[model samples]
Target: MRDILVTLLVFGGLPYVLKRPMYGGLMWVWISVMNPHTQGWGFATNFPFAYIIAVTTLVSLVKSREKNSFPLSPISLTLIVFVLWMNLTTPFAMFPNAAWNQYTKVMKIMLMTFVLMMVVHKREDIHKLIWVLVISLGFYGVKGGIFTIRSGGNDRVWGPVGTFIGDNNALALALIMTIPLMYYLMHDLRRRWMRHAMLAAMALSGLAALGSYSRGGLLAIIAMLLFMWSKSRHKMAGAAMLVLLVPLALLFMPDQWGARMDTIGEYQADQSAMGRINAWYMGFNMARDRFLGGGFATYEPLAFALYAPNPAAVHAAHSIYFQVLTEHGFGGLAIYLLLGLLTWRSAAIIVRRARGHAELDWAARLAAMIQASLIGFGVGGAFLSLLYWDVPYYLMAAVIATRAQVSLHLGPERRYARPKPLGRPHLDAAQTGPAKPEV
Candidate 1:
C-alpha cells in the first residue's frame, strides 16, 4: 500500500513537473532527501523515480521559456572545477569499478544541483525550495525527535535505509544542519500557529540529533547553535532559549549517551576513533605519494597497508576533508575548500548588502541561516565522510540563487553597496549646535 501510494504520487506529479520544471526540481528534492519510496517494503524501494524525474525535468527545462541559465559565480565555477577534478581522478582510482559507480552517483547529484540553480531564480522560488527542503528533511527530524522522546534516548535515531543518511551518525548531522533551515522558515512565517509549528519542529530536530548519540553530531549542534545565536537579531531571547533548552535536552539523554560522548576526550581508548585517525593518515599519505590520489574506495585494505600507520586498521575515511583528499588528491581538496569558502563569502555578501532593505530581508535572513547550517556541516563533517551529500550542495545552490536575487533587486551599482544605516539621521553639528551629548 505504501509503495502504491508513493508510485501514484510520483507519476501523478509528472505532468505538473513537465509544465513547470521548477516543480520537478522540488519534487526531485523531496524524493531524494526524504526517500519516501524507501519507507515501504515493496517494489517502490528499488524504483528509479529519481532518474525518471531527472530526465523529465531536463526535457521540460529545455522546452520551457523560463530563464534557465545557470547562475555563474565563483562558487558555481569552483563546483564545476571540482566535478571535473573528480572525473580526472576516477580513471586512476585504486578500484576502478567502485570509483566509477560512486562517480556516477555524485555526477547525478551535481547535475540536479545545477538544474536547481538554473530554475530557482525568484524570491518565491527560493522560498519554495526552502519549504521543500525543510519539509522533506524535517519529516525525519520530527519523527526521530518523537522516537527519541518516546524511547527516552535509550535507542539511537536513524535515517531511511540505503540512503546517505542511513546511519545514525549521518542522520544526526543532517538533522543538526536542518534545524537552522527550519528556523529560517519560522522567521519568514507570519501566522503564529505556523511559526509555533516550526519552532516545535526545530526543538524536536535538536532532540533528535542528541538522541542519535553521535558525539560528532553533538559538537556540530553546539557549534551551529552558537553561530546561530550570534547571528540572531534577538540575542537576549536566543540566549535564554539556548540556556534553557540545551541543558534540559542534555539531561534527558541516558547515561550511556553521556558515556559515549565522553569518549571524544578519550579517543585513545576507542577503537572507532583510532580507526578514523588511521584512515586520515592513510588519506594524507596517499595524497602525498600520488598527486591525483587513489580516487574513490581508496580506503581499502591495500591502500591502508601501504599508507596507514596501523595497516590492520582499515576503515572508511570518516572525514569529508580526508575523503576528498584521498580520492581526488591535494588539488581536489583545494578546489573543494575553495567552493566552501566562496559559498560562505557569497552568503556574507548577501547579508551585508541586503540589510536595511525590507524587500530583501528574507534573502538576508536566509543567507544567515545557511551560514549557520554550513557551520554544522563544516564541524560535523570533519568526523563524517558525507562529502557528496546532497544537502550541502543544495544549500550552496540556495546561496547562489539568493545572491543572484539580491543582485537583481539592488542592480549592478548597488550590488556591492554597504548596508544602509539604520535610525533617523542626526542634524549636522554645524546646524545643530555641535550635536548635544545624549542624556
Candidate 2:
C-alpha cells in the first residue's frame, strides 16, 4: 500500500512537473529530504525515485519558459570554484574508485541545488519550497518526538534507512537545523490554527533532537537556540519559552542519556572523542603532505598510517572543516569556508536592509532563521561528517532567492533611500535658475 501510494504520487506529479519545472524541483527536494519511499517494505523501498524525478525535472527545465539563468553571487561563485576544485583533486585521490563514487553523489546534489536556485524565485515559489522542506523533515521530527515520549527518552531517535541522515547523530543535527525553519513557517503563517500547529511541531522537534542522545547535537541546539532567541521579534516570549521548556525536556531524558552527554566535557576519558581528535590530526597532516589532500574517502588505513600520530585509532573525518581539508586540501578548505562566509554575510545584509520594511519582512524573518540554521550546522558539524548535506545547500539557495526577491521589490535606487515628500519636489539649481556647465 505504501509503495502504491508513493508510485501514484510520483507518476501523477510528473505531468505537472513537465509543465512547470519548479514543481519538479520541489518534488525532488521532497524525495531527497524525506525519503518517503524508503518507509515502504515493497518495491518502493528500492525504487529509483530520485533518479526518475531528476531526469524529469531537467527535461522539463530545458523545455520550460521560466528563467534558466543561474543566480551569480559570491556564494554561487565560490560553490562553482569548490566544485571545480573537487574534480581537480579527484584524479589524485588515494582511493580513485571510492573518490569517483562519492564525487558522483555530491555532484548530483550540487546540480539539484543549482536547479532550485533557478526555478524557485517568486515569493510563492520560495514559500512552497520551504513548506516542502518543513513537511519532509518534520515528519520524522513529529514521529521521533512521540517515540521519545513513549520510551521516556531511553532509546535513541534515528532517521530513515538508506538516507544521509540515517544515523541517530545525523538525524539529531538535521532536526536541530530544522527547528529554525519551523519557526520561520510559524511566523510567516497567517491562519491561527496553522500557526499553532507549527508551534506544536517545533516543540515536538526539539524533543526529537533530545531523544537522539547526541552530544554534538546538544551543543548544536544550544548554539542554535541562542541565535534564534537573538533573532526573534518577540524576545521576552521566546526567552520565557526557552526558560520553561528546556528544563522540562532535559528532565524528561533518562539517566543514561544524561550520563552520555556528561562525557562531552571529559574528552580525555572518552574513546570516541579521542578518536575524532586523531582523525582531525590525520586530516591536517594529509593536507600538509599533499596540497590536494587524499581526495574523497581519505580516511582509509593507508592515509591514517601515513599521517596520523595514532594511526591505530582510525576514524572518519568527523569535522566538516577537517573533511574538506583532507578531501580537497587547504585550497579547497579555503573555498569551502569562503562559501559559508559569503552565504552568512548575504543573510545578514538581507536582515539589515529589510528589517523595517513591512513588505519585505518575510525575507528578513526567513534570512534570520537561515542564520540560526547555519549556526546549528556549523557547531554540530564540528563532530559530524555532513560536508555535502542537502539542507545547508538548500538554505544557501533560499538566501539567494530571498535576497533577489528583496532586490526586485525595492528596485535599484530605492533600496536604501527614504521616501520622498508628496509635495512639489525641490528643483535642482539648474532647473530652478542658472547653473554652470560641466567641463
Candidate 3:
C-alpha cells in the first residue's frame, strides 16, 4: 500500500511538475526532509523517489521556457565557492572513497538547492515551499512531542532512518528550528482552527526538542525562544506563555531526564563531552598540519592517533566548526562561515526593508522567523557534526528567495521610492506651472 501510494503520487504529480517545475521542487523538499518512504515496511523503502523527482524537476525546468535564472548574490556565490572547495579537497582526502561518496550526496543537495532558487520565485511559491518544510519536519515534532509526554521524557525522540535528522540531537535541533516557522504559519493563517492547530504544533515541537535529551538542543531552544521573544510584536503574550509552559514541561519530565541534562555542568567528568573536546583538539591539529585538512571520513583511529593528545580516545568531530575544519581545512571553514554570515545578513536586510510595507509584511515575518531558525542551527550546530546537512542551506536559499520577492514588490528604486507630494505639485501648478498635478 505504501509503495503504491508513493508511486501514485509521484507519477500522478509528474504532469503538474512538468507544467510547473516549482511543484517538483516542493515534492523534493517533502521527500528529502520527511523521508516518507523510510516509514514504509515494504518496497517503498528502497525506491529512488527523491532522485526521480529531482531528475524530473530538472528536465522539466530545462524543457520549459520559464525564467529560471539563479539568484546571483553574495550568499549564492559564497555557496558556489564552498562547494568547489569541498570538491577540491576530496581528491586529497585520507579516505578517498568515503570522501567521494559523501561528496556525491552533498552535490545532490546543492543541486536541488540551486534548483529551488530558480523555481521558487513568487510569493506563493515561497509560501508553499515553506509549508512543505514545516509539514515535513513538524510531523516528527508533533509525533515526538506526544511520545515524550506519554513516556514521561524517558525515551529520546529520533527521526526516521535514512534521513538527515535521524539522530536524537539532530531531530531536536530541527524541531527547535521549526518552532519559529510554526509560529509564523499560525499567524499567517486565516482560519481560527488552522491557527490553533499550528499553535499546538509549536508547543508540541518544543516538548519534542526537550525529549531528545540533548544538552545542545536545550541551549538552542533557549536561544530560539530569546530571539523569538525579542522579535515578536506581542512581547507580553510571548513572555507570559514562556513563563507558564517552561516549568510545567520540566515538571512533567522524569528524573532520569534531568539527571542526564545535569551532565552539561559537569562536562569535564562526562565521557561524551570529553570525547567531543578531544575530537575538537584532533581537528585543530589536523587543520594545522594539513592545509587541505584530512577531508571527509578522515576522523579515523589512525588520524586520531597521529593528532590526538590521548590516542586511545578517538571520536567524531562532533562540532560543525571542527567538522568542517578537519574535513576541508581552515579555508573551507572560513568560506562556510562567510556563507552563513551573508545569508543571515540577507535575511536581516529583508526584515528591515519589509518593515513598513503592508504588501511585504509576510516577507518580513518570514525573514525574521528564518533568522531565528538559523540562530538555532548556529548555536546547536556547534555540538553536532551536521556540517553537510541540507536544511540550513535550504533556509539560506529561502532567505535569498524571499528577499528577492520583497525587492520585486518594492520595485527597482526599492522602498525609498515614495509617492510624490500632492500639495507641492498642486502649489507649483497654482503658480502657473504646467497643470499636470491634481490639487
Candidate 4:
C-alpha cells in the first residue's frame, strides 16, 4: 500500500498538480517533525519548508522517466561540481561542524530545488504557488500589522511573519522574496480582481517589510524595485501606489519618517561593514593569488591564516560573490557568471517572442518576473548567506528550463507548428490530410 501510494504520487501527482493548501501544510509539518537534519525544527530555520519540498520533489523524480536534460543547464552542472570541489578542497574551520552540516544540507536541498522546477512545468502550478504564498503572507501581515499598532509600533513585538526569529527582519526578507511572485501574478493575469488582490498584497508586503526596521531588508526592497523597474514601465504603477500610500502610513508610523530614513544609512558603523569589508578584501586577494578559489565555501580559515593575523577570528564573506571568489576561485566564478548570463538570455528570448501575442502573454510575464526575482535575490544575496530559500533561484532555473520547453512546444499553449510525421510524410496526425498549414 505504501509503495503503491508513493509511486502514484511521485510520478502522477506532482506533474499535474500542486498539492492543495491543507495538504501542503500537512506535508510541511510532517517533514519538519520527521526530518533529522532539521535538528532544530521549531527554531525558525528554513529547513522545514525548503528542505521538505526539495526532498519530496527529488523523491518524485527517482524512478520517473522524465528527461534529465532539464537539469543539465551549465549553471546547475557547475554548481554541483563546484559544491563537491569546495568540500573536498576548502579548509572551512570557523564552524567546521556547522559548515559540513550545512554543506550536505544545501547540496541535498538545493539540487532538489532544481528538480522541483523541472517537474512543475505547468502554468497553474505557478499560479497555485502565488495564491498559496499570498495567503501565507496575508495571514502573517495582518497579525504583525495589528501587533505593531497595538505595541505603539515597536518592531520587537511583531513576530517575523511567525518565524523562529521572532524579529521582523526575517519576515521582511520573506516578503521581499515574495514580491516577484506577486508581480508575476499581477502582470500576467487577465482577470481584474486577481490583479487588484495582488496589488493589495504588494502593499501589505511593502509595509510589512518597512515595519521590520532592518536596514538589510529595506535595501532588499529597494533592489527589488530597481529590478522591477528595469523589467518594464508597468512597475511604475506599484511605485505610484506606494508613494501615494506612504503619507497615510506616516500618520500612524509612531517613529518619525526622518528618523526611519536616517536609520537605513546609520546601521552602526562597527564591524558589520568592517567585518564584511575585511572578509571581501582577503577573499579577493586569495582569489587573485590562487585563481581557482581555495575551494567551495573555503574562505574563512584561509583568510585567517593569511590576512587576519589570528586564525581564531576569521569568518565567511558576507558577500556571495566574494565567497565564490574566495572559495570556488576564478574558474568557479567564471562558470557561475556564465550560467547567469545564459539564464538571462533564455528569459529574454521568451519575452521577445511572446510580445503582443495574447496566448503567450502569461509565459512572457512569468519569464520576466522570474528573471526579475533572480536579479533581486542576487542583490540581496550580496549581504547574507541566503541559499536556504528555494524560491528565487528555483524560479530562475524554471524560467530558463521553461524557455527550452516552450521553444519545443511544451508550455501552456501548443501554438508552435506540429512536427511532420515521417511514416506518412505530410499527414497531420489529428487530421488525415496533406497538412493544410494555417496562415
Report the Cα RMSD per candidate. Answer: 7.1, 4.2, 5.8, 10.0
Q: Name model 2 segments beyond 4 Å from true.
A: 413-439
Global local distance difference test of model 2: 0.92
Instruction: Return the lDDT, model 1, position 69.
Output: 91
Output the better candidate (3/4) by TM-score: 3
| Regions more than 4 Å wrong, model 4 | 1-59, 65-71, 74-98, 129-146, 149-152, 156-171, 187-196, 229-239, 246-268, 289-305, 309-316, 409-439
Model 1 alpha-carbon drift over 4 Å, by segment: 413-439
lDDT tens digits by residue: candidate 4, 1-439: 4334433433353433243222232233223222222223343334234454544545545545655344566556655665566565445334365456656765664555555545545555555545555455555564555555566555542443333324455556666766776777676668999788777767766666677665566677777776777776567785786577766765555665347656546555654556666777777777777755565455556556775533555766765577666666777666657656767777887888777777777778777776766665676667664434444455555665556556655344345788766784654567674566899
lDDT of 3: 0.89
Please give each candidate's TM-score: 0.94, 0.94, 0.93, 0.69
Please say which candidate is ahead in lDDT: 1 or 3. Answer: 1
Error of 2 at 396 (Å): 0.9
**Lowest lDDT 10-mer window, candidate 2?**
409-418
lDDT of 3 by residue, 1-439 (tens): 8778877888899899899899999999888988888877898899899889999999999998889998998888899999899989999998899888888898999999889888888888888888888999999999999999898888888888767799899999999999988887887888999998998899899999999999999999999999999998999998999899999988898999899989999999999899999999999999999999998889788998999988889898888999999999999999999998998898999998888989888999999999999999999999999988877888877888888887788764334578787674545555786766687
Specify the poorest-scoring 10-residue window by lDDT in model 3. 421-430
The pairs that clash in candidate 2 are none
Q: What local lDDT score does residue 295 receive in model 4, on the 0 to 100 scale?
A: 52
